[model samples]
Target chain A: MQIQIERIEHIVHENESVKTFFIRGVNDPRPGNYLMVWIPGSGQIPLSISSFKNDLCGFTVKRVGDTTAAMHNLRVGDLIGITGPLGTSFSIRGERILLVSGGIGIAPLLYLAIEARQMGKKVYAICGFERAEDIIFEDVLNGLLDELVITLGERTPLDVIHKLYEKRRFDHIYSCGPEPMMKRVFDFARSSQLGAEFSVERIIKCGMGICGACALPNGMRVCKEGPVFDLEDMEGVWG
Target chain B: MVDLSADIGIPLKNPLILTSGILGSSAHLLKRVASSGAGALITKSITEDPRVGHENPTVIEVSEGLILNAMGLPNPGVDIFLNELETLEAVNLPIIPSVAGYSEDEFGRVASRLEDAGFRIIELNISCPHSTALSSKKVIAQDIDKTRRVVNAVRSVTSLKLIVKLSPNVTDIVEFADVAIKAGADALSLINTIEALEVDPYVEAPVLGNVFGGQSGPSIRCIAQRKLTDIALAMWKGEIERVPLIGVGGVRTPKDVFRFLLLGADAVGIGSSILYEDLAIFEDVIEGLEQIMTDKGYDMLDEFRGKVISQILDMTI
Candidate 1:
């Protein structure tokens, strides 16, 4: 099933290497759903939907591979096949939520932060980048977040969580970043007896949940069961 | 439209079926693929006990079109799988249970239970590439005597149709195919994934946790076709009841399916392509195959079955 991109509304240069493309007329994907984007002749890749405004969706792409470089060349009115809103979403039950992201991992967490704010929940976001110039969505986060802490790579999101957990008393902590960073956060949260969930990044194919290519260590299908898994789901295995 | 239905001891709605390990995680997912247009579906290889399998990095795309995986045959065992099968009865498509075991007794026990559960077909999996990843013992498909004894043991326990899947890792696959057929296999799957290793140069380590895995995709298409051709040629010479060959390994397009059919494959399985295009690829394949048949003036599969082999034999004669 191929859904054609009706239009490209916005293409913002988030940083030196990242670009956010606003694809028009896609189904409104929840916080954790991903789109299997296909560029004719260039091949297909999985992209996390960054922003959602009714039918308009955003994909914050990092120019890291051949496919992403090819995706950067597309202009307005270009046709790109998208199949999706696939994968499990973040649970939105916590009263006070702590959101953390690093690098391109901010794509999904940014959308989640906005959705959580709109629902009248208190959202705290800890965003980290390698340097000052690498920081993205600065203005967006300032407006939606109850508290925004930006780190310039010196301190990780875990460090921020460690300092803030005693003061803020958050109901749930959610994170998506490099594996090492998330693993540290999971460890801290687990030791402190705090509920935490993190989104995993894997090689996803057939986003329709058929291909077991995205299977986790526990044999859970990331395309179907989760890209977002509760901390308990990753217990013992992470250690 | 071309009549793609096949009767390999049992009926299939089309020649394009979902290969084992592609999407056999849960019955709900299998039903989804069946409804999407797959002719039939096979479960992931199941063993007698639950398997935790290899760690993360079990699957990786090594190149543009190839994937290497060492999933280690992760399954919930037959006991739990039987429970899932109860939920799958609502699906209208034919379901074939794939069995993998460490010994002849394990194969017999699993096959016997599945037989009692009324499964129409049982695919004996002797070809998992990573079966030896945790241990030093050779996979059953790699040994002729082991293959024969395992197949015979399962055959004794079940009267249902038996399809023994073969490995492409062997020196002479046709020899093992002959032994399996003699041991009472009703059909055969041409090839499982080829044994391969991918080393990450940046880190100087094996990419898969199991150190080695199976290479699947367009890279193995011709190899599988050649193996199927060789075995079909041998079977023709031996006049061995013409057991249907289920061709697998890198079938992405209807043209690929036609190539397997020309090589004497009664049915074809789509594996790695599922990673590229998803289950809807089945519908595209069936439709593309129909269009190709219409253009080539093929109304039935029999008209084109082994047509390439016949042409080659005619030229030689």
Candidate 2:
């Protein structure tokens, strides 16, 4: 099952260590079909495709582990094995779309923004970072987002959550990030009376579903059941 | 001829069990494993009260292994657990409940509740790597007298079998095993997770939710064999074979189980390896064992528990 590796390039957007690897593949890898980069010796970890536009499949990755560390070591000409276009992707369609992200979690939703923009729908992205040092891909999303509110530092995620509550309503909301950060997004979506919101949870192993590893709120293995689930379905349900 | 009824003193249908942690958090997961073909199930370790546990990202994946944990042993209260067991009792599998505490009173109370509920085995966990040290709760198995007192206190209350789970994180595991035996523990279980650390080279950050986690999985096998042999040799020298010792960690297949038994483990507990396969893996391993036994005409498990040496001797080149 060898697929041609399409090159989706990046420009160093900021001083922070983030790069948007614009990728291309046939059957366009959806907004959440994270590619599994097979590092020769380090094995593989799933990296979400941030955006897939035209013929491009983009991965906005941060150096996180050995496999990721290997990704950071790559040059423009280096080729890596990507085993997916995996998991069920984010399928959202509505008049208004709200996208919230924490840190590197903002990567995948970058594509979703481009997607919503193409559909000529209203889109907003409320992205946050641990500190200013970890921000990336802001320049590309600036023009595409209707409400691209970038919050710097850890505390600002909360501040943004509270601000969104005071104003604005979207037909659909999407979030990805640390569990703590996502927990807040779930609450904000519920409080604002936002009807339908979804979350992209951090999942590991058994992306194919057999390992029983990545469990959701009800011991439902996230990989088999969902990496994307309706916020209303998981509300206050024990994870 | 094949039969599902066999007595290993404990009367298990198969040797495989849901060893510690998997769904040990609640009685519900325990019931699931029991139905999944585990001969028995060991519930996650519990304390006296409800705890909130560690913050998120509490679990992490490292190469061939995983590290988890709620720095918060946050369990539902003991009363809640026993109440659940009231339902668990109907699940039709032996529940080897795990009890942990920083103090004797805590362990004693939890054990008493299970004992009263007619639980047969209570595994007292004393080697949690992430738990806070207690003033009065003695790592008694390390100190003979404290082991004696805690064991005696729990022993005095009930007729249930006692098994003290020893931590591999210690220097001399056999020393602790001796304490458990001297304190009248019925049997022993060895080598809890090894305390280890994994790092992310880029961020230079630790991989686990807890900066350090007890390493489990195939990576710990060589240590497990060494630790098992060390404790076995010590117990053998003391002429104390009556206290059955169960070897845990690194048993990936029937071959590994054979090796552990040869190294002097009376029973074997397959841990993380089971995560890679289905729950019916118990029946698979047991069937493999039966085939091995049939080929050698060793009809009963007792005839082959540690017969690797005997088979080698009987073979002539």
Candidate 3:
């Protein structure tokens, strides 16, 4: 695989912790396909293709492991080998859609929302976080979202989702976030009979299909089968 | 009447063997072992090609689990592995050769060599984390047709008992296992690695050359167990007696081994831990099983298979 040094054009701290890396994909991977952004000597890790308009792609990361730790140390012009848009993608386009995000989960949804906006879809968003500052993508997300709600941690676990549903319904619900939050969102969708699509925030290893890391509650691999799923199937995940 | 002792399938008292990849990446390496002792040994995934695998930083340890990989399917390959076997004594312990190949023709060719040259059984690797031009290990295990195609192709050409390795890195493991069995698999290995990855906060990149890879170690065992238990349930529910399922993934202790057997595994493949310990772990595991088997008043290993899991989880009529 070809590796490149993506100069960190800028670092956007969406929350106090999670940061979004806007890297230039050497091979120009599409949104949904992640990159194994290589660090000089530390190691490589998989990051979702948060946004892919040009050769540039976005990766939202919460400080996690060694390589990521090393990454947290790097600045502009430090190069890394990028290896993937690996696995599959739900590069779907539509005019009518509901988009949802929690925490750093908005990265991929931001890119997806960009597509919906580009397509002139009346986009709806439910972006949740712990506090006001923890919310990333507020500015970019605001313009892309037709109907948006930022669910901060003030209320109970799922009170935000209840408020969103209390308002209006849409053709689809696109989502990503913590397991419990996603579980509740999907659970609500299932119980209420909302036609929505959700993606699990899987802790992946080989963006490839081999490792069992991103396993569903039922023991299925989430990498290959999904990052994006509907209520019909999300019902069986993360129990 | 069935000549149970005559069969003596595994001399290791417990029905479970740290089937391949548990220990013994090399004869000298699996020199000693400890922890949740099991019975027997199945070596790591060795292929006919000497692969370099992917770059380092291959493995990443995480919160209850880990994601690692060298892209390193990079084994010594068959020729050298076969050569290495010569200096090695017949591991008075049971040894089933775990072989991986890119195609059926290759799998058959390798199995034929192992059968003629050595090894009593052959475990076929149909799944592994691989690198794509763009990413690493992005593909899920196998589609229905590829699963059946590879299993059937290898089975048709081999006379020795064949064990097809199933991918836990899949949507429906039971469904895939069923296909392999129907295609003539003698035994099945449940759940390979889970596909996983990690990323950096500052650099905004992945940690490995291959973006994502299979996750192994203690954390995955529960998922493995759930899948294994389900596979067992399906086998029992469907009465698939002819095809035996060997449970693997996340087995660290004798109790875990016992649990796997109870959950319905003719044998269990021990991985990860053996990496943390020594090779002779086979002896330790076997010793433990001997005590448990005797305590249970079970005369044979078969008696324990699925007994524990069935009693606990089989809430059916």
Candidate 4:
């Protein structure tokens, strides 16, 4: 199940610290699907698909911990072992979809936005960054989305979500971001009586769901049952 | 080609058993493991009553092949778990139910129900390190009398092939193995995860939510072999009859499989290493073992199963 990395490039540099690796691999991973990128002697970590088409896929990686730092140092011709296309994909429910992304949590939602556009859905995106210069995927998102709202500085994605909610009602809210941001989104969805789902994070070992390493507070495994879960179904989570 | 199939009273496609508690909570996941080429699959340790287990961060990877977990035996209880097992009735692969309980009667009750529901091989879980969260009592496998009581209670219920799982937490694991064998266990899955703890140096707190966890993977490979050899020598001395041994802890590669077989394990149960390679590991290990056996001119599994045990004592003068 391991594939060779065909090519690699830095797709976006939001700032001095954050950069995206547009890795072209031989997998047609769907939106929300992930690949376990292995650097051999270094170690491996799960990278969510940001874009996939015709044997070319991308993983938007930010240099975070040890494994990711090693992954960031790879060149275009480097051969890395990739396993999966693992886990369930984000389920597109309605005609109008609202994507809330913050920081690197924008990775999976970006692919989801592209898919939503292909399905002829009205995709509304609220992307946030710490500074004005740190905003990424603005051009790509603008072309794919029906409406794109970029918030710079301390204005959180939740703030834009509130402003958007005051104007137009979304059929579904698909969110992935910092826990606090997702929690706020989950709370907003619950209070506003809107359908929403959130992509959660966990210490995943085997992306195939056998290992209980990625199990949530509920018995549900984040690797198998989700990296994405229906906000309403996430009972007692983040409580 | 080597005969990978084994008959430990019940039939197994190979010696690679998908050990309990990995993905045993659901029947769908069990079948997926079955399809993935595992010889057999053991369910998560289920008790008479439902257990919510511990809170988040139940399992974590400490290194490449090592894992620490204190899942506290989270299961849907026996009755609800049976619904999941019933779906597997159509699956051709062998289904072994692992039963855990606080007392002899509780273990007996669950075993009887599993037997009635048509499970042939039942693994009695007496050694879970995280069972402390379920009850204040020490692990049943740690004490000889409690282990005997539970095994005997399950033995009296039905004539199912009972595989008593032993804990590696004890000072003398062979004593517990002898007690289980004497109490009518048809087989034994030796060396459950060794009780150990890992602390976060940065935060100065235990890594596992339960504050302690069982250690598995390559770190415990030598320990598993040493314990299995010790118990095998005891069995050779007529302390207990030779039973089908399922060597469990820290098995990662084909060489480890042969090491366990040489120590008298009829089959090998892989738990933690599955986290490293996924279910694809079963196929990898099986293919590697086959190649190694062919290269060594070993035709049958019995050619090496317990071969190392003969060299353990060497009492002949």
Candidate 5:
């Protein structure tokens, strides 16, 4: 796949350190599919598709490092190179779904909520962040999801999932976030015997699976086999 | 039944080698490739010290089956890598650790450690085209003296089989192959990705972060074949000592493997094609090779190994 230079049509300042960029060019990317976004001088990094509507596609980025910091500086009409809609997307299953997200991991899950709701699946989400400022897509998730729970600081998405488990049940759970938090979610799903999928992040060098920089312990290339892996694939990986 | 085994210093069940630097970073990944039906596995080039490598945009697909990468040999360094190697004892296949360094002493030190760690075969990567971090901006394989010195440095420290991977960017690959062999290389794998650059028309800047990266994949197959044929022909005509050759670059099919074996390669390395086909490419190519062998009525690789070279020799004579 070649890099397609697309001009940023819009930018959403999600928070102090996170922003969502809307660009034209990504075609029909399912939720959980990522794009290798290239910032001219800084380099390329994979970003999850936060939103895609008609011709415009959005990438929500957290300014953690050089590439993302570069992405933060980009504005409307600035051209950035992109190659993706890559990796396996989340397979919407069951009548109801719970999305567990931490920090910037909420990006793809937000997209997932929009798509799942359209298909008549009841979407519930537990979005966790280090601080209130770190939280994003709150209003959007509230409008789209059947129920949205925001967790801050000591209270994690797992804590909410544990609390919510007593009151209601979800047919499926999807998580994206820091590895440890996702591991907790995966464990919850495994123990609960609920079907679940988690989107993971790695040092994705080539974004095409050949580089192997993003390989999980299971020998699956996060770029190709998945950024989103089902519970079975997550065995031993998180365990 | 058709056999696909070959002995390139080490006996292999097949001739498909998981080329160095694709997915050799960790022991788990290596173990994964080990089960993927590869005859042998070469680790990512391990340097003396950990290298962060180039900034992102380190690799880009120029087109389908063509990739440009300048990873700058980012490795966890030999010490940490040895820890990973310790777990590979159960992997079952020949695991060759590829080593790289800035100088002869560094090469010797790294090779000696791997030797002490019980690795029997080492692929000296003196051909990384985009390794500008080396003291000399130019790659070692591009210089005959540097190539010989590095090979000799490793050879002096360890009695293990040294497979010197040479650069295709050089004018005469046979000369370097000769020097490396004379300097004590037991086997040879070629050619490393050709040095090339891709500029984004819209961005008007280099595509790769390193500005220039090594080009690999199906597009460079003809170039790699020609380079491999040169050294193979040289060995045929007694210009260089006969060492097992690992033909690499753009090998994605049974036909590619057949051509490499016919031209005089004991094994063929699959690197960039993994980007397109994943680990299954190994089985796909091997199964196709078996099919081709069955159709051709050949029971073993030796039946047609270097057949093209022999044909060329016949015509020349």
Candidate 6:
């Protein structure tokens, strides 16, 4: 796919090192779908679509490396090249859904929460952060989600899930975070017989599948077969 | 009844080769391609040491069916790749490892290791366009002396079949092809991606991380065909040894494969087109080739292989 140059419509500083840039030009991106955000000479990195409305789409980026640090400097109206709404998106299932997010993984889940709320499904979120300052989308999730739980200071989202499972039952689980956290969530979901989906991250190149840079151990290209995969599809991936 | 089996030093069930650097990163991925019906598998270019390669945006699509990439030869080094190769032994297909190095000694050492591991075919990558080079020549294939020395170094260490991959960035690829063959290359695969650049006018900077990368896909097909035809004609005129040739660059369809074979390639490599069609392209191309063969009243590739070259020779005579 050719890169489409989009203008940054607005920018939101979500935290000290994280910002969400809402760009104009993406159309109909689903919750888990991601964009290969290009900063020209600095290079490109895959960013999940954190929010999509009308013709505008938002990407939540953390200042991790060169490309992302450059992205943090982009101002409103700056033109950046994008190639996506690429990869699989989360499949909305059941009347109630639980969102488990760790660190910046809250980006795509926040979008999923908004989408699920609009569909009249009860959306509950368990967001984990290294510190309270690192938390993002707090105000938005509190207002939009049916329930929001923030875990801080060594309390992982997995710990919250284990506790929350005792009080209430969820029909499905959606998670995006560090692999170890997601793997724990996957294990929990399987044991509870809850259907689950996850948005995974990898070193993506040629976001269109041909370059095997983002391929999982099972030979599934994360850029193509999924950035979001069903629990069964992820078998042998972590192993 | 159309038989597509081919022999490029090693025998293959068909002519579709999974070109190096596409999806050759791991054993499972190679096995996945094997299940997709590729005739042979060429691993990603492995070096003596692990290379992290360039930063993100190493590859980009300039246009449809066209890609610009400068992956910088990122690999886990030969030691790690050799373990992956052991897992690939269960694949039951010819797995040709593409070896690259910064020096002649590195090339020989890497190839010698693979030979010791019992691999029968080795594809020497002297054509990577964007890799860092210790030699003055940015790409070894650009310098005939460097290419010959690299090939000879590996040849001296291994009795395995050596396929020297040539670079299209060179002025006369046939000269390099001749030198490689004379230096003991058993076959040739051409052309590696051509050097190119993409500048984003909006950002006022080059698009790729490396600033410059190699171009592949349909855009380079005609250029690759011209280069292949030049070497084919040279072979026809007895200017170079008659060795197997694997034509690569923008081969997406059965007709593209037919054109390459008619130009005297023993087989064809599929690379960038995988971005468009994915793994199914292999099965799709194979079935299409069979249909085309059936329509042409030929049951085997040899009946039509180099047919165009023969006709050209007839016209000239």
Clashing pairs in 4: none
* TM-score for chain B of all predictions: 0.97, 0.86, 0.83, 0.95, 0.97, 0.97
Regions of candidate 2 where Cα sits further than 4 Å from its true position: A1-219, A223-225, A228-239, B1-9, B65-72, B86-89, B133-145, B234-238, B278-280, B308-317
lDDT of 4 at A10: 39
Q: What's the lDDT for all of these models?
A: 0.81, 0.65, 0.64, 0.79, 0.90, 0.89
In model 2 chain A, where is the ten-residue run with the lowest total lDDT? Answer: A1-10
Candidate 1 vs candidate 6, TM-score winner: 6
lDDT of 5 by residue, A122-184 (tens): 888898999988878888888898889999999898887977767658889999999999999
Q: Highest lDDT: which candidate?
A: 5
| Superposition error at B156 for model 5 (Å) | 1.1
In the order shown, the candidates' DockQ scores are 0.10, 0.07, 0.03, 0.10, 0.79, 0.77
DockQ: which candidate is best? 5
If scored against the real structure, what TM-score would every candidate get? 0.66, 0.62, 0.53, 0.67, 0.97, 0.97
For B122-219, candidate 2 gives per-residue lDDT tens digits of: 78777666554211232444565666677777777777788777878667777777777777688777777776655555434444444555667767
Instruction: Name model 3 segments beyond 4 Å from true.
Output: A1-239, B1-13, B30-38, B64-67, B131-141, B239-241, B275-300, B312-314
- Docking quality band of candidate 4, CAPRI definitions: incorrect
Q: Per-residue lDDT tens digits of candidate 3, residues A89-192?
A: 55454456667677767777777788778777778788777788777777777766777777778663367666665675565667777777777777776677
Candidate 3 lDDT over residue span B1-317, tens digit each? 11112122334434555655433455543333212344455666677777656655565444443545545565678888788667565445566778777767777788888888857677777777553423543332467887787777777777777778888767777788888888877888877777777666555666555667677777788898888877787777765544777777877666777777777777777766543343444556566666776777866656767785667554666
Model 6 spans > 4 angstroms off: B133-138
TM-score of chain A of each: 0.94, 0.86, 0.84, 0.91, 0.98, 0.98
Docking class of 1: incorrect
Better of 3 and 5 by TM-score: 5
Misplaced by over 4 Å in model 4 are A1-208, A212-239, B134-137, B315-317
True contacts kept of each: 0.14, 0.00, 0.06, 0.13, 0.77, 0.79
For model 4 chain B, give the 10-residue run with minimal summed lDDT.
B200-209
Better of 2 and 4 by DockQ: 4
Q: For residues B165-191, could you state the per-residue lDDT of candidate 1 as single tens digits? A: 999988998899989999999999969
